[model samples]
Target: MKLKKIGASILAMAMATSMLAGCGEAQTEAPAEAQSTEATETPAAETSAATEEASATTEAKNIEATEITFWHAMNGNLETVLTEITDEFNNSNEYGIKVTLVNQGGYSDLQTKLQASAAADALPDVAQAYNNWLTPYLDKVVHLDDFVANDFDNWDDVVEAYRDECSEFGFVHAVPYNKSTYVLFYNKTMFDELGIEVPKTWADVETAAKTVYDAKGISFIGFDDLAGVVEASLHQNGVDYVDATGALFNNDKGLETFTYLSNLYNNEYARLVGEDGYFSNVLSNQQIASYVGSSAGVSYIKAEGWELGVAPLPGNVNKAANMAGTNIVMFAQDSNKQLAAWEYLKYITSTEAMTKWAVGTGYLPIRQSSYETDEYKAYMAENVCAAACYEQAKDFFFSPTFDASNDIRNTVPGVVEQLVFDKADAQTWLDTLTEQINAQY
Candidate 1:
């Protein structure tokens, strides 16, 4: 069930009124009025050793060697980097918190396992989670604020957008990790040869694509992540996907966006992701001059003979783009293990550690201080184009990701496919989908 304020209040009241029952038992149970957050909010508590009463509340402050399991879907290079960091945390933590990394194959596999584990009440101490996918486990997850709120490297230190993203559960139930924003990967050699400047807006994008396509007689620009592009474009132009009443994108701005992009594709100014699933795979091919994709796709850029340039996402009235990533959530399990997980989270988000993660993977650094650190600045300098995501970081925004968010999000791909591939009248499909979403709501 979707968690509302009242649903969360009882869980909050129970924990606020009680203390930890013991080390390895289920946390102090809340009253029925304080219904546990199942796919609800989350569980949490705090303790300080300065006083006995404070000590009674915050037992996590105690030092204990704890072994915790962390389940994730990261694999390949991403997995290597995360594992490196996990090793660092396990070795460096003063308390004996040994974090065991378990790769649950792809995201689907991880989600499947997490659901089964949640059902069996055999959840790991910590797991990586997406905001939309985390609701059902709310009552089972531990809210991090009360336990780690006052830490120096906690929420306040995170980028404003990331901090807002992690608060989707109405509380700090997750920590921002391995996050990225979209970027325009352009061929500098192609741009220089064509005498086109980097695009500053969607209108500029059309002009640049037309110039390149006209000169080469090949569809020049392809945009990956069609779902995010379309949704973010609407909001950037001051349109909402939905409002209190229903879907709000049936207006002039929405029609204008779809129509504009449709014409761009029909005129052969845009390229679809062709036989290859990702447009990035074809960047080395001469016909493809540029594509807009995730900054993390920097790892996939293989334009051997040409100079690659990265630019912040093309915007409209507002410099807006979507934030894409997952967060690490501590499940409601052993109190000591919860505390160990908190320390590990705190440690990873530290300036040096976050910088290492950002450098190893193409993901953006999560901490404000990480951006200012010498290592990160030097990394961004050598790989100058990689800075585009950070340039548009402040403009990053989230969709209204709540109960019906996934179903709402799923409707966009069909809308995008029709617009890009079939040149369908976007307003018609948008009208249909908006109503469909409202009905689902």
Candidate 2:
């Protein structure tokens, strides 16, 4: 059962005041309500130390290492890079543990397998996880505190925000594996034909979109209008999804972002594509001058045979983009397996593995150490068009999906769809929609 706060308090009170409140009582009195808060209140430092000691004790057992499963979603060219790294680990590591990498379909399929594994006590030692799924798995997963303390190279120097997100459960659930951000893919031929300069700001994007539209009578760009895109826009504008109390995306800036997208839809500057390769079809036909999509789309964009220009996602207030894809999570596996899994995690996050991964696939590397290496720098220089995505790495934030984030994802698109159809005023529709979303969450 889910751990309800009220039930926890009552449980604590029963332990603390059991002597005072008799044995026969079903609904006991709240006798001075001084429940033990210790388990939940120990500082993060103490918790880290305790977890380290626990890991050390497990290591001390000297149990024979066994084979462990490692579930992931590295399809297409990306799959080759992951296998290369895994093979290196399997062949060279002195540790007796063996990891069998399993491809478990896409992100949604992985989540389904994870939940079933949790129920059957069959979870792999390490599995791929999305950020939204990380929260609920906190208690059931192994934190990386011990792993980092023992084997991490310059691990402490990771950016504070990125580290904190990974370590919020008092242990690092997963190391930041791959990083990605949004970029505007423009038609270089079209831009040159119209004499339009590449845009670096929101005003520039609007002007260019309008210019291309007026000149060619085609929508300059298309956005998915998915919550990921909306969250990116809002975050770039310095808006957050939560505040001191709880959820806070239903705010003024958020409403304004919604309104702005609606205005674009109404004016024909940006249009949303229907499912079933709608955006891809538009791109192939050259009906859209630009498309803002995931950096992971690099390979697919190249295959479409259209010359592409990749530019940093434009921002009105600040530079930011919502991170997409998944993270690597080592679940509550055997202690020996956990350490071995961590060894693999650390090895893959190193500069060598990162370069191979990026070159094979389109994923951006996660470590600052990556950028310092000549190989990564050379790769970036070789593909200068992707520099905007590389530079925006520092500005990556969690996408809008929280525990109940699906609510926002499902609802926000409908609100925009309504506004695009001109069924309601943009601001009015968003305000009401945000309230409904908050309530659902």
Candidate 3:
């Protein structure tokens, strides 16, 4: 949709003029979209009851604004599905709200646009953002604690890990949307032919990789995300790769984990998905025995005459995996626009909508109940990749988000690159990595 392009001052002035001219107009307040109050636990059904009561009392108030803008990075099939849902909302909502979607090409482009728009006080009513990307807009984004409390009867249905990440600043400010976690994809036919069982632990992974290498004289395991392995491996081994105190991967635990990973790569037991891109083709062609990558990549794994398998990431002291994706961040706006955005968020995240989204995009549904939906169950029966994602959903953890989070995140894989490819000293490279990440603070 073309931007309305009205200056903030002019919009405010027009609102004032309309208010002045409506001195004798009949007035009926709109249904309270959300009651302002401190965050508190309330029965999930209370919100639906409140909306019903509000609707029964009177017609909605006369607000001159009924249109809201949404900005996102979704494209191709993702964009088509999102647009279809929004069109459904526009055609059916009784609130007379029309949501105009503006696709900003890609995530990086969307982030740059959102930053510029926030600086100019022209942010859209809603946009997609990652936890780290939200630092710049905290003051201008709505504190969604009250909205979640008052507007969602099925709020608890949302995944707990996503809930933890959304509550970044003491209260919820964003809602989970496109979410996915790391999973291990393997060649089921190869594993069975080799008499190898699926790995469930980190040590098992090492043995399996080494077993394949010894038997075939070729590295059969590939990790698409080196930094992800570093984080989740260390996390499961009792060390946070990063936290509020900054990078923690240079310690004793880091040494052991880093060394373990370096041996896998340097010894030619595993390969990294560097500039060569994804491991999908390699795994499908039986050039590799297994690979670790995002659950969202399920749709990309075109298995050719080979049975594929997916399972949660192998664990150590604890079973854990890292989550990645965007959430819907509602920018601060007038009550009417905010209400419209809130309802739109609710609509998109509902079990029905999320089921379609997961099947359409390969992203995990944000709600637990979505997995139980008939559509989702049927989809999972056909594709087990999503089922593995759901199995590990409760164990997923997001990194502590800050402006420097992505920079530090980007740096870790670089360290892994040097360790594996350059064959650098593990301790020296880790110490340098730690120092570099610390300097970002």
Candidate 4:
């Protein structure tokens, strides 16, 4: 809720007058893997131009103009950007395909309404969902492999990590839309005054925290989400959170991550977010020197007098971060509406449109080409806060998708809270939590 609340406030203030509206491996070879999964059938050598033209003509005739509804959880400035993008798509197309935008409050609200609609056989044409959230509704959703094979020409341009997340069993079930990753936001003023360099590794973080606390008597770092920190630490150490068999967070690497964070908190070098629940205010007031949070949180961080700096999260065994955000999934519908929805989906994810989306909102562009575009480069040049996120985009991973994903994700905070506040034994708590998660599987 703190994430949503802070983002909403900053987005609303800027809008005032205008709108109302893979856990797998290290993923080093993701691009090649993604390309291999795409359908690659091509016309034969003897195929003529006439044959191609006729096939195109026949396919065009099969698709009919229709209105398709899109349900999303974006609000405030995000909704405003979505409206503009959707309107542009609607206006540019020659087909009379109209996309209706529906805001379903937040992600949780959207999930509830989506489930209810599915039970009633009244799902929308398309909706936004996290990869894990699609597990229960796979039967009702359209796999995009055929669509990508025939229609989408820029399939290779999508970021590899995102492409992998949208795929399951060598098939793409969704398209990455709003995507982001974690970054370290720190106070440059404090770092410079205290003779502490920007942290580039876990050891650097410890040294900086100790230096700051010794000199100024303030907690050096505060994590908005303890689970997120734990996950990132595990990934940096080359460990998975879960797999086909069971939870892997109780392994030796997991214990090391827990011990690291516990030591930080116990030694007064770091703290979890407090009751006020806004790190921007905490940082601006000089209560803490830095925090690890989403890249989309740039608008929420207000370091008035001090120069705010953003960097990739410090690495331990390796440099890594957690990928966050949702994908656009089309629900099963009549051919006409499905075609219309696919057209809208392709249009929105196009390089030109996604450039606008990424620049307008703080979210990263899913397309690799979007990053090379002049517009995105200009925006990045002006707004340096998001540069590190984009730079570290390739070095990120997603949690494995499973039936108990939401439940498993929800269990983390309680386990982490016990470690941070109650001084619970790390190995015992993790072992118990691992058992509970394995039971769900």
Each prediction's TM-score against the native? 0.84, 0.81, 0.82, 0.84
Shift of residue 302 alpha carbon in model 4, Å: 1.3
The stretch of ten residues in a row with the least summed lDDT in candidate 2 is 29-38
Please give, for residues 1-441, the per-residue lDDT of candidate 4 as tens digits: 000101222223222222110010011111111111111111121222211111231265466678899999887678898999999988988788889999898777888899889789789989987655655665677657767777885787786667766775345668888776677878888898888888988889899999999999998997666556766777776666665567776778888776677778888888877674656568868789998866666666666787878777898887767777778887877666667787899999999998999888878777767766888666766665555765565466665565666666667766777667876565765676687667776
Per-residue lDDT over 84-124 for candidate 3, one digit per residue giving the tens place of the 0 to 100 score: 99998889887788999998977778878998998998999
Ordering by lDDT: 4, 3, 1, 2
Write one digit per residue (lDDT tens) for candidate 2, span 238-353: 67653213345566877777676766667788877765243545665688888776666544443255456777778888766555555677776556676667777778877778
lDDT of 4: 0.68
Against the true structure, whose TM-score is highest?
Answer: 4
Better of 1 and 4 by TM-score: 4
The lDDT of each candidate is: 0.65, 0.59, 0.67, 0.68
Model 1, residue pairs in steric clash:
37-139, 39-135, 39-136, 39-137, 39-138, 46-58, 47-58
Worst 10 residues of 1 by lDDT: 24-33
Q: What is the lDDT of residue 250 in candidate 4?
A: 74
Cα lDDT for residue 292, candidate 3: 83
lDDT by residue (tens digit), candidate 1, 184-269: 77778989999999988878888888888788887767777666666667767777665334677877888887776677777888
